[model samples]
Target: MMRKTLTYFLTLFLVIACSTVPITERKRVNIVDDAEILPASFAQYDTFLKENKLSTNKEKTQEIREIGQRISKSVDRFMRANGMIEEANQYKWEFNLVEDEQMNAWCLPGGKVVFYTGILPVCANEDGIAAVMGHEIAHAFAKHGQERMTSSYGQQLGGVAVALGTSGQDYETQVLWNSIYGISSQVGMLAYSRTHEKEADKLGMVFMIMAGYDPEESIDLWKRMKADSKGGAPPEFLSTHPSHDTRIADLQRYLPVARMNAREYGIDE
Candidate 1:
């Protein structure tokens, strides 16, 4: 009876929570509320800015901000056109450049973005920056973080369901079931993260192109990323991100589609 009830509730929850991602139209189950997560995200972003040193190079910092503004405005236009104005308005978009030596950049929910100085060289130029910027913004735009939190909660609930379902089983059988669940859940999450990464890549290219940036630069950017890694990246099956080689190939294949979609929006460039 408990198992049946759990199954019924889980199905109901999934049905209620399902949503389609913008651009990609992929269906996802996200139980986390923007109202619940955005305030915390804003607070954390504030704390991070207060703790980090802003870049001293005025020219580069201004460049990053300019590119961010263009890309973000394009994204805003897209959301509003698609009748996602409320979601678009919720974004308090801000971009920053930090004085750090890590080739990293990220966007927190609600459109807070940061770029480390070390990545500038990898970015190589304005086009490169747009490639990275669009990708990071896509993460926020898609609400990947919130989706991940929802998935984590689902995993915990699944664990509880497993415990309840196995209460009648012998100790050894329960242990085996849990062991299988643990391994499978971890791998499942890694795969989920990779999917998010790829989706971001595709969405980013479209956003960049819509903003009149070259979508093909994204391919070159990934090629540089591949060369920079020097073959040290983990195997794709075990990593949270697709391998650089995989990304470069994927970008190549998707460029034509991205350009076509951009043209539909009247972006001839």
Candidate 2:
């Protein structure tokens, strides 16, 4: 009975979970839709703002807003030109500078963005900020977060299958199978995260160039990011994010293609 249940869910997953990413056309396994996720995301964003302090640095705050607006406009143009107008319209487009020292930034679904002060020195200037924001925005544009959730559910379902399949086994054997499932699922999740990060880098660079930022600046931004990490990051296989060197190299390789994409929007590098 458990085997039959597993087969049914697996079949349904195969049937309904395939989606193509907008810009890159990369196929992803994601069953969740925007309508299902955005309401919760917006609420979460509002709650985050209420709970955290907004940055008081007027100059830096203005810079973040300006850069975000430019990239948001460019992203709109790209989506419209590519027949994603409905998707573009769904974005509310808010940018905020939060008072935090972590070198981090993220764009929630529906285009809510928050940047930390600690990342500012690394950004160095408006173009550098664009580089960072562009990458972060691309994560939203690509719906990587929703894909990640769907993947997590898929992994959890695998765990259920293991539990059910081993119901008749000795305790030690079930423990062994569960352990194997846990490790394999974690590794798969890490791989999915790394792929999303790399794709975001490529799409972000293109978006930044389309918004009139220098594509070459993205490599510099990643170099700063690497230097900022100080070689203290976890090894690539176990980490959700790629190593700084890997990201820098990927950005360098994608530069020409990003420039070509920018030209399609009438922005030449």
Candidate 3:
């Protein structure tokens, strides 16, 4: 009876928390409140800036900031046009270039963006930078962090449910169940991350196109990334992101749709 009650409430909670992502319209569960998460994200971002070295290359820094501004403006336009005024107002967009050697970049919630210098060579050009920038921004635009937090909570609740359901089992059986649950939940989270990556890829293409970037450049960027990997990347099923080949193919397939959507938005470039 207790197990059934827990299950019932869990389902109810999930249903109430369900929402759809903008543009892609994919259903997501996000129980974490923006009011609760945004301030924390901003504070963390401030701390990160204090701990990290900002790039000294004025040229590269200006370029990143310009691209970020263009893309963010496009995003804001889209949101406001689609009746997302409140959401648009929530973002305090800022971009920075960090003096790091890692080929990495990320966007925190509320649009705090960082670009590592090592990624510039891989970007190869403005279009490539836009590709990476759009992708990272899409993660924040999609509220993936908040969704992930909600997913963690759900996983913990599932652990509780597993414990309750196995209370009558022998110790050995209980141990086995828990081990299985742990492995499965970890894998599930990885899969969830992959989903977010794919969604971000698609959404990024659209945003880049809207910002007058060449969508085809995204495919080329992935190809370059694949070459840089030299075949050392983990298998797709085991990784938190899609493989490079998969991303390249996805961008290729998504290019026409992205361009069409941008045209519809009156962005003809």
| Top model number, lDDT | 3
lDDT of 2 by residue, 20-114 (tens): 88757799888888899998999999999999999999988998999999998988887888799999988888999999999899999889999
Worst 10 residues of 3 by lDDT: 260-269
lDDT of 3 by residue, 8-114 (tens): 99999899999999878899999998899999999999999999999999999999999999999999998889898999999999999999999999998889999
Residue pairs with colliding backbones in model 1 are none
The clash count of every prediction, one per candidate, is: 0, 0, 0
lDDT (0 to 1) per candidate = 0.93, 0.88, 0.93
TM-score of 2: 0.94
Measured with C-alpha atoms, the lDDT of residue 90 in candidate 3 is 95
Residue ranges of candidate 3 with Cα displaced over 4 Å: none
RMSD of 1: 1.1
Candidate 2 ranges with C-alpha deviation above 4 Å: 265-269
Task: Report the poorest 10 consecutive residues by lDDT, candidate 2.
Answer: 260-269
Instruction: State residue 94's C-alpha deviation in candidate 2, in Å.
Output: 0.5
Number of the candidate with higher lDDT, 1 or 3: 3
**TM-score of each model, in listed order:** 0.98, 0.94, 0.98
Error of 2 at 70 (Å): 0.8
Per-residue lDDT value at 228 in model 1:
90
